[model samples]
Target: MTGTCGSCGRDDEDVVLVRRLYVTPEAWDTPGKVEQGDEERWCFVCRTHYPHEELGQA
Candidate 1:
């Protein structure tokens, strides 16, 4: 799918859906499980530049 990358905010055709892993404020102290944040579409360049868990194609 074609869309703006969530990371770099660049328009690209090869955008893909990725699951952003992050620790929530509530879980910061515990740090037991990493929470899955927003699923965003990212371009190939951003996807490579930033490490993220791939959910699938957008």
Candidate 2:
């Protein structure tokens, strides 16, 4: 799918649906509970270089 990456905001043809990038928080409301952020469309390059959980093809 060709679209803008949610991370880098770059146009790419290899964009796919992926979980939002995770950020380390100073404190967690519930420790040990993994919080998966919203899904977003991201280019393959950004997905490979950044921390993201793949959802599927966009």
Q: Each model's number of backbone clashes?
A: 0, 0
Residue-level lDDT tens digits of model 2 in 1-58:
8888888888755788999756665555644435678888888788878777888874
**Residue pairs in clash, model 2:** none
- TM-score (all chains, Cα) for each model: 0.63, 0.66
Candidate 2 wrong stretches, greater than 4 Å: 21-34
Deviation (Å) of 41 in candidate 2: 0.6
The candidate that wins on TM-score is: 2
Error of model 2, residue 12, in angstroms:
3.5
Candidate 1 runs further than 4 Å off: 22-35
Scored by lDDT, model 2 comes in at 0.77
Q: Report the C-alpha lDDT of model 1 over 1-58, residue by residue, as the tens digit.
A: 8888887888755789998776444465664556777888888887777657999974
